[model samples]
Target: MDNLRRRHITSFQNGVLEPIVFDDKRKSMKSILLSSIKLQKTIAPVLSTIRNFYNKYYNTIHPLCFTFLSFLTRFYLISLSDVVMWDESHFGKFASHYLNREFYFDVHPPLGKMIVALAGWLAGYDGSFDFESATRYPEDLNYTFMRIFMASFGVLMVPLAYFTSIELGFSKHSTILVTLMVLFDTAYLCISRFILLDAMLLFFTLLTLFCMTKFHNQSYHPFSANWWKWLIMTGISIGCVSSVKWIGLFTTALVGLYTIEDLWNKLGDLSIPKIDYLKHWMARIICLIVLPILIYIGCFAIHFAILTHTGPGDEQMSSLFQAGLIGNDFAENPLEVAYGSRITLRNTGFGGGLLHSHVEEYPGGSGQQQVTCYHHEDFNNDWIVLKPREMEIYDNETDVEFVNDGDTIRLLHLATESNLHSHKIPAPLTRAHWEVSCYGNDTFGDEKDSWVIEVVDDVYKRTNHIRSLTTIMRLRHKVLGCYLRAANVGLPDWGFRQVEVTCDKRNNPKDTYTHWNIERHWNSKLPPGGKANYKSKFLREFWNLNVAMYYANNALVSDPDDNDILASKPRQWPILEVGLRLCSWTSDSIKFYLLGNPAVWWSGTASLMLFILTLFWYLVRRQRQYTDFSPGFLMDQFTASCSLKTKNMIFGIHYALIITIFWYFKDIAYGVSSPNIELKDKKWLSTWDIVD
Candidate 1:
């Protein structure tokens, strides 16, 4: 048996039995423990490697966290106590109406107000005009919620700006710089504090740019399904931009031009045969032209549906329809009416358009020479160097006397009148240049010398005396001269008016007297003797002058007008409201200028077309020169330096999709929570209303 066992052992050593014996019982257990220890050691390093990989790849902050931070920063930057800048008041009013489901006129589209209303609803603040609550109220909501929403938009802009900058061949540092500049700019901050459409418009504009960049860089076979989806997305983004502002139509034109350039660039070295060229071209055309139009029309359809069914209030709906009808009519006939009355009411016989009249020949005498004096030739050319001419004031105890070398003088005579007393010193003397000076001693020397004098009547039947006469006199000579004289005598209050002047040449009598009104003096060059019917037109054009002067004065006293406020107020039928609001903070002229129908769309379209044509020509020339083309070349050139690591790109795309989906569902949630009858009464709401 031992010999057999030894043989078995020897055989087993070559096979399995000897190994089993060597690892028997306690030895086997020790061996197994060693193996287990080795496995445990290996597991720790492997697990550690895996954990480091995960942390490196997926450690970005949640989007919600960033969103929250953005909101907080916005609220801090825009304090609640901040006064409503010009435009914010209009937006605030609209948002309030939106929250209450009350009607409000809107010249602009409803997207911006809708955003503000959404924020207010999320915060559980009722949009009422109640002034009782210090916090959690509509007024508070107006500033706070709008700030938070806009701040969030501003923050979201950072990544998009970075992406666009990178795509446009900028360095990472440049991207950061652009983002920081946008974030900290006073214009951006001021705009974010109010509910304005610009932030939203900018956001959509950037998004469209990104989509176009993506389409230009992506690698896709002709007619690939994935390529079609990207093209559709590009069209949708551009359409969304246009819906925000009519200026977005320019953006659509840009996309169409890009598509044409892309196709032309692919034409020279097309990998596919000529037979397939037409198909590829058709696909591109569909993406560039047909798809964009469809998307644009789709957005309008949504707008139409919303306005028809679920618009804020009855009055708002009526106004919206009326505005729409008016817009349609204007589109059909774009002619504008000229601003002028049938006949020139104030005809000096030398007339034309108001702007066409010469300054020297203005009905209100030439600005060059005064009635009694002329401008000095030694004055500086600089406007700031010109100062008001100086005049002297004199007091002679009993009477004031004004002396100047000029032929004209303005006499302000202060006299006291009493029912108990009336007295005069020297009057009833008619010389060549004699004119009535009421409440004054109308005395004249034998010579045609100008004089200003006043008589005073005592209050308690006392003797009358000359109180005071203040005169501003200008000497008619080669040089401009001014002098003032004053005398004081105790007197009560009285009123005076400038009387008509009749000049005698002998006393030189030249029919030089003209009609004087509150603001200006009207002069007509008629013969020395004729039926000179001088009627005062009282040109209330002072209103226009005051408006212009107001702007100039404000420029001198404060900063330039707030453009943020001007840009926000809508300008359709609701323009009256915007104008009223602007008048509160700006000159009437500026209000008119902003509200006036300037050619915003036409100018923008022209610029867009020029850019598109230039880009097209450049792209075509490049394609002709370099015929060896590959899809990879375009992709690599367009997106080679973008920091879209595979994992991050995938994650970003997923996150974006989720956010978009969330937006759609959030609208639904808002609808469900709304105080409408469909939700409250358990009635089935049509899909048209829901989608809207």
Candidate 2:
């Protein structure tokens, strides 16, 4: 190539008289200038052809080819590592529950699991896999069906991202870049191939952003059916996104902001009538908030309907609530309440448990029998309600006496045959009051063991009975002048890790910690039809389930225990400082690791940071340029400067970052501040990269 260039230069010199050009410097400069112009004219066509070719390939063919390759890679060997990885155990079991029409509880909403179940059902999964942790999947289980279902979402993400970039006004090269980033992300791939909810969440979130981008690009054509389609699709996608995980709310928020900005732009348009603002408001309200909520509720309703038979999740709900489900023991016939009834008491307090006693004595102080509140049901949970004074059986009359509010009673533990007694001893945990324990002789009680029943004010006017499903009451220790409080804190090992029971001096009637309700009652007078009305039962059960879920989610503690060295933090995510162990072979020869690819993740982080800086820069420049602006006028100026497409993309990036951070905190225990640790050794980590 060099020799050819030299030959061409010599021929050009021979043709143009090189000696004259060298001899006269002033003429040589002018001659050189003219030759340069002639050379540019000759090369312009070639450069333009090269530019056109680059644009054609990068803009037209690149994303298409990349998306095909992404799908191929995601679908290939996706089921090679045939084992339950990380959370697959939990989600797989949830899928099994849905297939069997059996109810189960989980921290997340049911849409993702329902999808998994639907895929499995379609692919011939018999709901036989136990989905236990570290267990090898049976050969007959429909693992590939569920995995392919999840991977499909991942495969779809590439094209969705590509179109979203185009909608955002990105060049062909930029769109290709976006497609490649999502296509090759290792963490995303790993999550997609597994039976987990995160893949579904990502899919719906991307779909939501893509639909919103479409809507934004078509905002000028509001009267068009395409705009309405995109708007409704955006709302439905939001519902699906949020149904998979609450982290999806971030995407919903971005859509909302886009709608607001779109309306604001309309308000700024002097050509449009002011009354048109009302139309925009009505359109957005119907499409964004109202439609999404309906779809969201519809998802839950479908979930409840499909999981008709009772299963493991029943224990989390109330006994009365469970009595309404088709397959629960309480659904058919419930007994009436009567005095001296053998019953089970349940507290409605947060993390509150049933009053229970066992043969084990207290750990150290006072060494009396251990009495505590347990969340789970056990034989020891049963108790007998007896009046303060022992009554002889009136052999002549067979009518049973009913217990009531303000009735003084003595609760005798059914298992240990000890009275539910309170004394002056300090509580093991809540030290401000007296300790509660079962401390009386068998089938006998002392005055100190007496408790005065005070039904919660709402039910106080009515007579108290064991069959009163809505009853709430408190037990006041007659001798201690205090209320029996089921302190939410757990006791040490001696108490079997049950919640501590204490006697509090403050007799607050409304204190949930001291409230107890009768759950199971035994009497012969009740009819057979009972309270098993499926529709109302489902509603009440759903409400209670939501309440419990809300409480449990908010009450989650983020402080890791001493043994939780593998816990991750939100801040560590951006730096790729940690990885989750997905699965490992029992022989230690193979493993799967869940971590993001450095090339994809770090570049994305950098790009997002650049986006943030660009946004700030744009805002500052806009503010400085537009000085004489009203509040609405300034917003109008801002919207005009940043087109809706660009604004949606920016907001989408922001939402992605926010959701990632939100999920990190929600899933991982991230309350503690810890020093950032770099991955100093990059040795054999790829051995666990199942995709490789």
- Expressed as tens digits, the lDDT of each residue in 142-208 for candidate 1 is 4555556766665665467656666665533334434433433323333444456666777777788
RMSD (CA, Å), each prediction: 23.8, 10.2
Residue 418 of model 2: what lDDT? 86
For model 2, the stretches where C-alpha displacement exceeds 4 angstroms are 1-64, 221-224, 257-279, 331-334, 363-368, 390-397, 423-425, 441-448, 452-470, 478-482, 505-512, 524-536, 554-566, 585-588, 612-692
| Tens digit of per-residue lDDT, candidate 2, span 381-426 | 9988777655453343467777777878888888888888888888
- The TM-scores, one per candidate, come to 0.37, 0.76
TM-score of 1: 0.37
**Whole-model alpha-carbon lDDT for candidate 2:** 0.72
